[model samples]
Target: MAERLPAGRLVAAQFAACAANHVLPAGIGASAVNLRFLTRCGLSTARSATALAVKAAAGGLVRLGLAGVLLLAWPQTPRLSTTIPRNSLAIPVVGCIAVAALAVALSRPLRHRVGRVARRVLTDVRAAHGRRSRVCALWGGCLGFALLHAAVLIAVVRALDVTVPAGHVLLAYLLASGAAVLLPTPGGLGSLDAALVLTLTAAGAPGSAALSAVIGYRLLTGWLPLLPGLLVLALLARRSVL
Candidate 1:
């Protein structure tokens, strides 16, 4: 399926659809069955959002950490500087240059190390804990998701016939996304919307145009992804795929 589609998108979409079906809030009753194997193996069976949330946090921290290093080395980074903005968030991403040539050793060591840590943690919890642990390949997932989001944004901006540099677009996304993390609202509702307006406007995008772009992007990333997921949950609940 992924081979039939461009850029492995179908595979991502398929996992997303399946997860949405199984992980809906109403599917709480069904989740136990789908996750029974993990439970039998004595692993975490809590919310899928738990792993995704951790991934988001890990993504922010890793990107911020990388940005800090770059900013220190070149304090007065020009708005046009292409180095960090293009790849800052990607530093921790799996299969990237940083993960390969740089942290090759850590990547291999983490599996064994994480397995040991997971066992120790589980040992302490025993039967008392109701929720299971949810550890994912967070760095890679976030990078992939972010890339998908960025691709949409770039496509929109270019579709609008704008000549804005890619650096400006990426910088706006990173900064706005950083602000989105600060707010407590689910998925940075109001804050992210505002940040998009402000960042794009600062980059000379007209308020109305930028607002439209942001709204469109949100529909794709937020509502579009979520609604189908919700439906999947509903259908799975009715069919018992939880």
Candidate 2:
């Protein structure tokens, strides 16, 4: 029931989607593109939306788990000792979690509403994949992007003449980038820049050096391809591919 585009157009649409993701807030661009792609692949609107939501939730959970592991495994460097709070941060985090849990527990109507959506999503998944393969594939792609993003951070730090542990940089990038998702800004524009700079500085990098690294990372990952991606989007749109 969905229209299929040529391979070239499909690739163009993907690039355009990536561009849109960098240009829009709250990841709407990526979600829109993904839904469009899935629909083109013959999935229904509900199934495509459900798949995207499931992928995002799964990615968030994985990032959170990774952050926890990094916090436990890595020792706080001396540079971070003064700026990082050990006890104070946990209280707010725990309180927020408790409040959220209590609210969810108390709101039966809300739960029922969400339950219907969840059931429908599951039905769509079962009808398509019969297993969790689609979710797994989405997870794999998310992890791959995170790793590449971390690698970009490492490169930026090194270029700025900063010496930090590779593992630490990777962990910091992962955590900061994940946190940036909470603030919806175009391509995480200002929000991501601030978060990454703060994160790197907290990780012991000099503030100025961290700022430079963040700028470089953003230029490489967000800004550089923006125009090209838009151009691709235009091409696809003109060809009636998107």
Candidate 3:
């Protein structure tokens, strides 16, 4: 009986810790996600939209910084991708800018409606949690962390010496990651690798190259990072911070 109590306490503490560590980032991601959907459904706000955009930008900068680190540590690693033609780069960059401008232009009216919807969603979410709001916050943090991660995955893949278009990689990731939500596994382990490989292959990458890239990415983004997460969870458990 005593043993069981300690185990239970351990689980609860880790859950609490994970939740506590993840709120602001998750809220930022959720707000952006919410605004994206709400805009389509007739709700939007500059303040909310801008907040999410900033979070996205902050997240992007973090990835860019990581890329810079890779350049310093393993100069050859970044060469995994094919060099983009100068002409192609200009067109793609222009297209991305146009899309951003369009999104902003479309947001003026949509933002007002989204604010109301966000308020309503919050009310219901709060009601659903009742006394468990902290748990919800922790989950939100995990979510923020995940969204930031997905963006990084696409970025890393591009930064590697590959030839596929970034847009295609992003789209493939969006679909696979979305599907991974309902997949019954911790961190979508097998599904994510499968999805990434298949998506990359479909985008015209050779089997060997795709496999190598995925393996390298999995090492950095998965196996290596997990050691730390496990260590953190373990230490937290011993300290009864679950």
Best by lDDT: 2
Kindly give the stretch of ten consecutive residues in candidate 2 with the minimal lDDT sum.
79-88
Candidate models: Cα lDDT each: 0.53, 0.74, 0.50
lDDT, model 2, position 58: 70
Q: Which candidate tops TM-score?
A: 2
lDDT of 3: 0.50
Query: What are the TM-scores, per candidate, against the unseen true structure?
Result: 0.54, 0.79, 0.42
Tens-digit lDDT string for candidate 3 (69-186) = 4335544423222222224334655888898667757897666666675676565445434555544443454456645665666666667667876555544454444343334244
In model 1, state the lDDT of residue 85. 47
List the candidates ranked by TM-score, beginning with the highest: 2, 1, 3
Model 2 lDDT per residue over 1-242, tens place: 12233566556777888898976798899788767776766778886788778777677767667766777678565444333334434566688879877887899997787689879977765654554655455567777767788899999898878988887787777667665665778778887788788778888889899999998998898788889999987776676556
User: For model 1, how does the per-residue alpha-carbon lDDT over 116-200 read when each residue is reduced to its tens digit?
Assistant: 7556545433422333321223455656655567678767877777666555665567667765544435455677778777777
Off by over 4 Å in 2: 1-11, 77-113, 124-136
Kindly give the number of clashing pairs for every candidate: 7, 0, 19
